[model samples]
Target: MPSVQIKICGLTTREALDAAIAARADYCGFVFYPPSPRTLTPVAARDLADRAGARIGKVGLFVDPDDALLAQGVEAGSLDAIQLHGRETPARAAEVRARFGLPVWKAIPVTAAADIERAAEYREAADLILFDARTPKGALPGGMGLKFDWSLLAGYDSPIPWGLAGGLTPHNVCEAIRATRAPLVDTSSGVESAPGEKDIGKIAAFCAAVRSA
Candidate 1:
């Protein structure tokens, strides 16, 4: 099997960014949602993305942002990909890709078998699909720090590239990967000291687990 790719999300500080880079994370995600504790301003995100350089891909995480906000992120000049973590439709995903000229990663929340089945509808619209744990009925969109049953993804196949996210920590990331054989894994709260605070040690440990897996 190919090596699993690791993406450390919700990075807000230079220290955290440095830690992710040192750990050789395949992707570093910046939250653009204002409600998220990990949220960053376009300027702040640009700085971190610039510091990230080309060693690792910089991902802009958005939740139903408007065209103006999305354009600001693209103009920031550090994002290599855009991750839609909201209820955007396939047409919206296609529009975002065309407008920004960047690879788009559509996040699909999976809590039941049917959720995985819906991924097929986005195969042609998104460049990649991220399977995340579904939020509670009245909760926020992504980064809920909850996990769905890994068994739901067993033997899963799709034409578009895909990834796994939600509640992934160093302790269980390997098991998650082992069970689903996900090519890419995304983490937010799992590597944080607090809701929005990223722990460098945890970042390194998480990456180590991915590499070992």
Candidate 2:
């Protein structure tokens, strides 16, 4: 199998961003949602985006964003893709993709086998389908360090490109890849020492684990 692609998300500081780059992460994610501690201002995202300079993919994560918010994030972050983590429908995702002229990644919250079928709904609407653990109602959508059964995805046919997230860390990412053969893997809280504080050593360790997986 090919090396698992890694995405280190929820980056808010230059030191963290630099650590992700040095770790050879395939993508660096910036949160645009205000509720998350990792959220970044457009101005802040611009500085980090400039520093990134195409060395790695820059993804902007939003939750039910308006067009103005999307525009701000795209331009500010020089984003290569937009990740919609809200309760957006397929039509809405398509609209966001058309308006931004960038690839759209729709996050699917999974709890059971039936939830995996939901990816079919975004077949034409999204470039990728992110299967993250389902958080409880009234809680944050993701990045909560929760995990579902990996066997749920084993050998399941998917209509679009998919990845694994939720509760993944350096210790378990290798097993995740082996179990799901996830083309990509994402981490936010898992690599952080706190809710939003990304640890440099953890970042490197996670990436190394993925590469070796």
Candidate 3:
């Protein structure tokens, strides 16, 4: 089996970032969404980003962000990619990519096979499409520890590069990979001890699980 890529998202502390790096994660994500418990200010993000410095790919996660928000987040985080976890149209995704000149990942909430098919809409607009579980009304877009049916992606042909997210814990991540054959897997709450709290042990375990799979 091909090696799977791992992204540990919603990192809010130096210790957490260090744990992710030490565990050999390919990507480290910083949340820019205000309402999420994992949210970080540009200044705070900058500290973590500066410390990260080429050790791992830094990603900035945002909701339906405007250009100004994106600009601040990208500049401060020195983000390698922008992950949009909101209701952005394909045009907006393309616009973000053009304006920022960075790889753009649009998160699609999956509830059914049709949701997987919707990824085609972002083929031209985004650098990658992330399939995550759909949250309930008024809940956070992701990092909810909720997962969709992985079988929905079985034998599914993606129009562009893609990744998997939502509700993945170290215990189940191996099975998740086997079910979807996903090239990349992302997690946030799965490695946390509580809301917005990153557990170093969990982070290591999750990465090891992905590699073992």
Candidate 4:
């Protein structure tokens, strides 16, 4: 299996953070959206980031947040990247990048082939585009453990750096990677004991699965 970058998202505990570090995940994601089960405040996220101590990429996940919230998260968490998981327009993404001088990653929900094409409009605005499974309306933005058709990404072309998310578990990540040829993969509920509760063993196993793929 070729090397695949891994991101453990929705981490809210130091134990889980340590597991990600030990497992050599490329990114550590902290949700800033209040409604998420794994959401963290800037202050708490700051402490976790400090504990991570440059061992991993610290990503601050937001949902159509304002400038003030973005500033606060960056200041407190020392974020390495900003993930826009809401219905943020391309112009807004560019604006945030200009204002914060941090790498911007846009989360695009995919239920149809056309949704994947949406990344074209964000080429200049975001450094990364994460394609995730589309959830039912009124559900949480992500971490619902839903997955899109991997065949949709077979030989897929992306305008920017990209990753796969949603419904990825240790059992299927290898198939997902092989099918999509995704260079990076992100998981939250996939390695969790419950919503917002990460399982260290699963975390380690998932990373190993990616490596073995």
lDDT of 1 by residue, 1-213 (tens): 998888999999999999999999999998888888999998898888778789889899999989998888776737899999999999999999998889999999988999998888887789999999999876878777899999999999977899999899999999999999999999999999899999999999999999999
Ranked candidates (TM-score, high to low): 3, 2, 4, 1
Models ranked on lDDT: 3, 2, 4, 1
The count of residue-pair clashes in candidate 2 stands at: 0
Cα RMSD for predicted model 2: 0.7
The sequence of per-residue lDDT tens digits that candidate 2 reaches over residues 1-213 is: 877788999999999999999999999999999999999998899999999998899999999999999999999999999999999999999999999899999999999999999999999999999999999999999999999999999997888888999999999999999999999999999999999999999999999999989
Collision pairs in model 3: none
Off by over 4 Å in 4: none
Candidate 1 — which pairs collide?
A: none
Cα-lDDT of candidate 2 = 0.95
TM-score of each: 0.97, 0.99, 0.99, 0.98
How far in Å is the alpha carbon of 104 misplaced in model 3?
Answer: 0.3
Cα RMSD (angstroms) for every candidate in the order listed:
0.9, 0.7, 0.6, 0.9
Best by lDDT: 3
Q: Native-vs-model 1 lDDT?
A: 0.91
* Tens digit per residue, CA lDDT, model 3, 1-213: 679999999999999999999999999999999999999998999999999999999999999999999999999999999999999999999999999999999999999988999999999999999999999999999999999999999987888989999999999999999999999999999999999999999999999999999
Model 3: C-alpha RMSD to truth?
0.6
Stretches off by above 4 angstroms in model 1 are none
lDDT tens digits, residues 2-112, model 4? 589999999999999999999999999989989999999877998998999889999999999999999998888889999999999999999999999999999999988
